[model samples]
Each structure stands twice: as C-alpha cells, then as structure tokens.
Target chain A: MDFIRQVLDRVGDKWSLLVIAALEAGPLRYTDLQRHVPGISQRMLTLTVRQLQQDGLVTRTAYAEVPPRVEYALTSLGRSLHHIVTSLITWVADHHGQIREHRAHTATRP
Target chain B: MDFIRQVLDRVGDKWSLLVIAALEAGPLRYTDLQRHVPGISQRMLTLTVRQLQQDGLVTRTAYAEVPPRVEYALTSLGRSLHHIVTSLITWVADHHGQIREHRAHTATRP
Candidate 1:
C-alpha cells in the first residue's frame, strides 16, 4: 500500500501525466517532451521525469554522441498506462458539462 | 484538456486517492472520510472533499437534522473510476518487484 500510494502521488501530478502521455508516441529527448507538454518548465520536466524513472514509468537513455544525445520513452508499464491516462482526459472532455453542473449543484447545497 | 488537467492535478494527490477509495463502500460523513484516510489532517480532508465535490468525483448530501448530518458518496462518474484507481493500486502491488528492479537498473547506469 505504501509503495502504491507513493506512485499515485508521483504520477497523479498534472505534469507527470502529461509528460508520460507525451512520450507514448515514441522516444523523445528532454527538449521534445518539454515542447510537447505545453507550459511545462525545464525544471519541472527534469524533476518529473526523474521521479517517473524512479517509479519505473519512464526510461532516460544517454547516447554516446558528441553532443551527448539523450532520449526518453515509456517502459512497457508506462505505455500500458496510456489507455487509462487517455481515458481520463476523454472522460473529462466528454463530461465537462456534467462535471460543471455537478460542481454547481454541490456549491449551492451548503 | 484544461479541465481534465485540472482534475488530475486535484486528485493525483495521495490523500484524494485514499479518501475516494475509502468512500467506495458507502456514504461517509466528513469525519468518516477523515478517519478512513490515515495521515490526513482535518483541514486537508475538508479542502480535498470540497475539491472532489467541485470536480464531481464526490457528492455531499446533508440531512436537515439537529447535528447537521452530512454524507458523501461517489457519483456515477466517481464509481466508474474505482476500476482505474484499483487498477493503479493493483499495478503497484503486482509490479513492485519489477518497478524496483527497473529503478535500480536505471539508477546505476549513470
């Protein structure tokens, strides 16, 4: 439970979800992931990717190229989460109206 | 994207996940939710539930009674997320070994 709770805390962050989803397409360098996930800072992406790597959701690879090329991609576990992550976004888009109404209903109840 | 992103940020927290899971059994009052989720502060639960209520993941109903009885239960959308949340937990439990190994492998590579 502790381990799982830790991961939920790690990935449930908005940046982590978007960052992982951004990499689902294929390997991305740090810069690429930064660009793909709009509004993420270099600092935040570095931190989130490091955390995801610790949690085993992302893999960071360093190439032996002269300029020190590096790339990030989803591990199998990370890719597996694509469905749920995407589902979450899909659910939100589809139900924004219902969600809004639900909130409004609750706000007035008190 | 904006709305969904906001919710993931709201709920990806450890407290929110556990609180929602705690309420899966049935309606819980504010106190009930707090007790069920260990390590939660009184103030955090109040804030989290208010957010969950705003996002429609939780519904709070108050009975017109002497003590101001209130109960919270998962909305339909909230119930739908049980599988996903449970999946996240199950994934962690099932994969803790793999996850640890993956992290170890990455950490030493640098």
Candidate 2:
C-alpha cells in the first residue's frame, strides 16, 4: 500500500500525467511536449521528465546534429501508466459536468 | 483539458486517493478511515474528507446519537474515481519492483 501510495504521489501529479499523455502517441522533443501539454512551465516539464526517467517510466535520448535534439519516450512501464491515466482522463471528461453541478449546489448552501 | 487537469489535481493527490480507497468497501467513520489508511494524520484526513465532500465525491452524514456519529461514503463520482485509481494502484503493484531497480541503477550513476 505504501509503495502504491508513493507511486501515485509521483505519477499521479498533474504535470506528470500531462507529460505522459503527451508522449503516449510517440516520442516528443521537449519543445513539442511543452506545446502538447498546455500550461506546463519549462521548469516543471524538466523536473517531471527527470522524475519519470528516474522512475524508469521514460527514456531520454539526445541526437548529435548541428542543432542538438533530445526526445522523450515512454518506457514499457510508462506506457502502462499512460493507459491507466488515459482511462482516468476519460472518466473525468465524462463526469466533470456532474462535479460542476455538485459544486454549484454546494456553493448555494449556507 | 484544463478541466481534466483541475480534477486530477484535486482527486489525484496522495491523501485523496488513499481516502477514496479507504471508503470503497463502504461508509466509514472518521476514526475507522484513519485506521484504514496508514500514515494519514488526523488533520490531513479531516481536510481530505472535507475537500472530497466539497467536490461531491464523498458524503458526510452526522447522526445525533449519544456520542454523535459521522460517517463518510463515496458518491457515484467518487466511486468512479476509485475504480480508475484502483487500476492505477494495480499497475503500481505490478511495476514497482522494476521502478526500484531503475532507481537503484540511477543512484549508482555519476
């Protein structure tokens, strides 16, 4: 349970989830990831990718060229997590309106 | 997308996930919930439950008995979130060993 909690604490965060989702279709350069996942600051993206790499959920590769290129792709574990998070995102999409309604109701209460 | 991010930010936190999981079996009093989710301080539990209730993922019922009884149960939205989170937990259980190995390898690098 503790292990699960730690894992959730790491990957279940907003930036991490967005980063993982951005990488799900394929690998992406840092700039591309930033564009794909809106509202993520450069510092937060860097930190999130570093943590995901450390956790073995993402791999970072740099290409040698006139302009350096770096790309991030999901490891198998990351892909697995991506699938679960995608499901969660779908759930949120389906149910957020209800949550909004509830929030409105709560707001009206004394 | 921003809506999903907000929802995830709220319910995807460590304490929130644990609290929702703790209530999945059924309703539980505050003390029972504390016991069910280890490492959660009373203050954190109180805040987490309050936030969940405000989000309409949890319901708090207070009984006017001799000692006063308060119990928490999941709303349908909360239950849906729980199902998704359970999948995430199972994924962590399946892959945490690999993550540990990755962490160990990363630690040894200069």
Candidate 3:
C-alpha cells in the first residue's frame, strides 16, 4: 500500500501528468515537450522529466551530435500510467463545470 | 486547464485518495474513516475531508445527537473521481513490482 501511494504521489502531480501526456504520441526532444505541454516552465519540465526517468516511467536518451540531442519517451510502465491518467483528465474535463457549480453552492451556504 | 489542474491537485494527494476510497462502501464517521484507512493521522484525515467537502466531491452531514454524529459520503462528482482514481490504484498495484525492478536497474547504472 505504501508503495502504491508513493507511485501515485509521483504520477498524480500536475506537471508530471502533463509531461507524461505530452510524451504519449512518441519520443520528443526537450523543446518539443515544452511546446506540447503549455504553461510548463523549463525548470519544471526539466525536473518532471528527470523524476519520471528516475522512477522508470520515462526513458531519456542523448545523442552524440554537434548540438547534442536528447529525447524523452514513455516506457511501458509510463504507457500504462498514461492510459489511467487519460481517463482522469477526461473525467475532469467532463465534470469540471458541475464541480464548479457545487463549489459555488457550497460557498454561498452560511 | 488551470481549473482542472487545481481539482487534480486536491484529489491526487495520498491522504485524500485513501479517505475517498474508505467512503466508497457508504458514509463513514471520522473515527470509522480513520480506522478504515490505516496509517492516516487524525489531522490529515480532517484536512482531507474538509478539502473534499469544499470541492463538492464529498458531502458531510452532521446530526444533532447526544454526542453529535458526522458522516461523510461521496457526491456524484466524488463518485466520478473515485472511478478514475480506482483505475490508477489498480494499475499501480499491478505494476509496482515492475516499477521497483526498473528503479533498481536505474540505480545500479553509472
């Protein structure tokens, strides 16, 4: 249970989910990922990617080229997580309005 | 997008997920919830419940009995979130070993 909680803690964070989702289509260079996931600062994107790689959810590869190229891709574990998080993102998108209405109603209660 | 992120931030925390899962069968009192979710400090349970109530995910009802009774149950929105989070929990449980192995492999690398 503790292990499960730890995994959830890693994957459930906002930036991590966004970064993982951005890499769902395929491997991406750092700049590509930054562009794909709007509103993520470069520092946050860096930290999120490093964390994901450490947790074994993402793979980072660096090329031996002139300018140097690094790409991030989801491992199989990451793909599984992506499937689960996509459902969550979809649920939030679908019900956010209702949740907002409930919050409004709750706030007005004295 | 920001709104969705905020909602995820509320529900994605460890204690909140545990509390919500504990309420899945039915409404539970504070003590009952504490017992249902092992290792949860009273302070964390209180905070999680309050946040859930504020977000309109969990509903809290207080009774004017001799000792005063309060019960928490999932609202429709909470139920929706529970459905999504359950999938995540299941995925984590299923793949935790693989993830552990990956972490071990990564650690041994230079």
Among all candidates shown, the one with the greatest TM-score: 2
DockQ of each: 0.56, 0.75, 0.73
- Candidate 2, superposed: residue stretches over 4 Å from native: A1-3
Q: Whose lDDT is higher: candidate 1's or candidate 2's?
A: 2
Model 2 chain B is weakest, by summed lDDT over 10 consecutive residues, at B84-93
lDDT of 3 by residue, B8-63 (tens): 67777778877877788999998999999888888888888988888888998999
Clashing pairs in 2: none
Query: In what order do the candidates fall by DockQ, top score first?
Result: 2, 3, 1
Candidate number with greatest lDDT: 2
Error of 1 at B91 (Å): 1.9
Which digits, one per residue and each the tens of the lDDT, describe model 2 over residues B6-88? 98788778788888888999999999999998988989999999888988999999999989999999998898788887787
Indicate the TM-score of model 2. Answer: 0.95
Per prediction, the TM-score for chain B is 0.79, 0.93, 0.91
* Candidate 3 residue-wise lDDT at B92: 77
Runs of candidate 1 with Cα error greater than 4 angstroms are: A101-110, B65-68, B100-110
Q: What would the per-residue lDDT of candidate 2 be over residues A19-110, giving only the tens digit for each residue?
A: 88889899999999999988889999899999999999999999998699999999988988888888877777788888888878988999
Q: Pairs clashing in candidate 3?
A: none
Which CAPRI tier for candidate 3? Answer: medium
